[model samples]
Target: MSLPSADADWWRNAVVYQVYPRSFADSDGDGIGDLDGVRAHVDHLARLGVDAVWLSPFYPSALADGGYDIDDHRDVAPELGDLAAFDAMTAALHEHGIRVIVDIVPNHTSDRHRWFRAALAAEPGSDERDRYVFRQGRGADGSEPPTDWESDFGGPAWTRLDDGWWYLHLFAPEQPDLNWDRRDVRDDYLETLAFWADRGVDGFRVDVANLLVKDLTEPLPDRAELATRTDGNHAYEDRDAVHEVYAEWRTLFDSYDPPRMAVAEAWVPAHRRARYASPESLGQAFNFDLLTAPWDAETWRRVIEENLDLAAESGSTSTWVLSNHDVIRHPSRYGITAAAGQPNEIGYIPAFGVDPEITVDTALGATRARAATLLMLALPGSAYLYQGEELGLFEVVEIDADKRQDPTFFRTGGERLGRDGCRVPLPWTSAPPSYGFSPEPAAAPPHLPQPAWFADLSLERETDDPTSSLSLYVAALALRRERAAGEGLTWVPAGPGVVHVVRPGGWHCLTNFGPEPVALPEGEVLLASGPLADGLVPADRTVWFREA
Candidate 1:
């Protein structure tokens, strides 16, 4: 496949910043972030030089599935504000030269969704009922779940509908999987895409995109044989038919004047399945290899090499993410722990089994955290910065049982606490009340004070301080744009744990993940996130050297 012309593929080198709207910043004091809140932060993102902002699901929902179970695709959630606020946000982002990409969940809709409600109320075998997958059991024996496969949140993947049939729920029971086989469903999705496109949304960060279509006849794959489980939800993910769905979406998107990019959240290994996101299909797929790659020189080299090779073979731009709303925060993932007596050994034990008050310290300190940020920003491809990541925020240590909101955490008998730790509110100020998120009354009665860490680390205090993480991120982003590293980069293998990335213009980036100083073949140090004198000390340190 020939590469798209450089002028035509500007998104190939774009950097996307993801915002979990609920936690970003609250403008109306509803104790929740809203569209207006997002508008308030657009300037900050613009100054940071991100190419686009990907807002996680802000659509109307019952809040059962953390906005993934969307009830209305066209309207914003009431808590997030109304259509007018959304328009204002779009305008603000565009004014700052930042594209806006909202999340689109096409696979399933909240059971409360009007479509699902109507489908349930309709007689079986009726056209409305046919919109969703409804199957009768082969007697009492088959009435249970079709397979032993568990939902990503745990328990059976199938839920018994009030109409006496079973419906598949790849994630939560409240989220009934839509029957993509139904022409109505497919048409509805196309219309939804058009609706947003007409609204000026530049693109979409498709959620569970690979699960949009499923093997209607085959039983769910056995979990034991799968290579990996994402959020513990693999029973119905990555069916080959998903490719067809993506191709259809790609065609629809191409019909528009300026082609809209679709970024899929696929967990397939980068090298083995890069073709899934070929130009003919979706524009890009998330690169989990970088997120889960071992913290070592050789591992990093192999992963990047494989990724680049895959990109070359598939002729598709790669997408990289360090953390998102669904997983543990990267700082907690890579930070060293003193309790573990090793670097980058933080354990993300949820508040289920352990004593609610237990605290385990990680050895990774401020320096290591800084290094990780530098490496993430320096990487080539579309970098996804999770909301609050720029502030060097760590994972929330304590989550009360009542405070827990993730369905995955509750479904797994508390085995996997899900993503509640990372989904906590972003701290905009140090003052105690509401953490400056919103003035709205707390969702739960007897509003609780914002966590203490918010005071310890906040954007208000750090944004202007040169030594703060927020300042560092701003500076790095400025450098990234000024040097045009946001453009495609050429990877040159230097040695283990050290690689030279040549970006557009005359810029060069050298990354050393090892514990010892690396000798640059020839360059002058432009920026160093760790002890430059030591070459490259491990546990989160990156050195950028430019050709003199």
Candidate 2:
């Protein structure tokens, strides 16, 4: 496959800001975000110094699995505006020098999709029906899922369709898994990519990408066996055939000028992540180790080193994230406590006589968070910034039971509440009534409650405040871009929780995820985050040391 010109190192060292359109901005006063709303925010992203914006799925669907379950690959959902709005958004983003990456879910489609509907209607042997994987004879009894593999969201991976055949759904039943084994399925996705690319769309952030292919030979353990041995569901990620599917996609993407990129949502080990980006596969894959790693120095360092090493070997770019739409915020993960001396962890409230509000003594300070942010931005790869992370926005608090929407909560039997808390709308202004997100008055007819913390911490305010998280992110991006840090670089080990390396310009990057401060003999502090007031001493922070 051909590569883009060396001069276009945009994907490397580029900052990608993820926009969850449903909650980012609402232009039509519909209380839900739309393409027009995203169009209006393009300038804001440019102002934030991000190189591009990765939009979540806005495709037509039943909204059962958020937008991941696509019913139509070509049409935009009516609630999110029409195809015209998408074109306008893309053009507007391009004008701002910011690229647009749309989310593509190839593993599955909504049960309501025409293909699935036709498959359901057709007899078992129909050629049109082969577009999906439908299997019979589960076992001697035929009463359980095909395998003991657990779904990422929970529950059995297979669902019995009305036709009495079992269809696999690694996520939700409504989100029926696509039959990648079929040539038609692959061709359809290629055409979908071409359609968007032809429309000037830059690239794609593929959703649940690693599950495109699965092993059909293994039968799921019986329900009783699964219940006793492990979680009774499907393990659909990181399967062997995923590489082939990705290679196919990469080949198609290469045909386009500038080599439109593809980033996979691969929740796998660092090494597996590397394999997914094996040059011939995806351009890059999101690194979740950082997000999942414990909030300790050694864990962080090891994760970073593993990622760097894997990326280097795979000939792929490194990517990192501290938070995303589907998980808890980073602050909460780090154990937010009042005694730690920081703001209250966004996820937890101060329960009287229980857990009090976190103060500077108990909370993770701005410096620590900033340090992590800087390290993520300065790393030798593309970076993904989740919506509202710039302002150190915390996850939504006090979610009412009725308001909770994540399917995981149901599937996991409430063991995990799902990602609804993180998917709440972005609070642009704290004025009142939907926190400046919805246009309606606070106590008006719609009567939507405003996100209080959003008003307290917003891009508008953070942009003005030098100490604000938003400002810190901007500074970090500026430094990364200035150094041309995206160019040829190698990741070398610097002990656990540390990524040590030299860039093409003879600049050394020493980042420590360890709790204890690390003293670098030489190099200026490009950016510091954590409790270090002077930005010199490292605390619970990440700092880049370039030779002075």
**CA-RMSD of model 1:** 4.4
In candidate 1, residue 295 scores what lDDT? 65
Q: Largest TM-score belongs to which candidate? A: 1
lDDT of 1 at 320: 66
What range of 10 consecutive residues in model 1 has the weakest lDDT sum?
344-353
lDDT of each: 0.72, 0.71
The C-alpha TM-scores of every prediction are 0.88, 0.85
**Candidate 2, residue 245: lDDT:** 77
Candidate 1: deviation at residue 175, Å?
A: 0.3
Error of 2 at 377 (Å): 1.9
The digit string of per-residue lDDT tens for model 2 on 1-548 reads: 12234535467667898998887888777677889989887777888888788989998888777788889998899988998899888888888888888899898899999999998989986886678877774667566566665566788777876666787777888888887888889889989998887787777898877778754555545545544431112335567666787788888888878788888887665556777777698778888777655555566566667777887887877888887787666655554554555432222223311244632221553445666676666567878888888888765545665666677767766656667767887777656566667676422211123356667786666668887788777777777777853446566556555656677675566566555555564666666664444333454666665766
Candidate 2 segments exceeding 4 Å error = 1-7, 137-144, 218-236, 336-362, 365-367, 441-450, 486-526, 530-538, 543-548
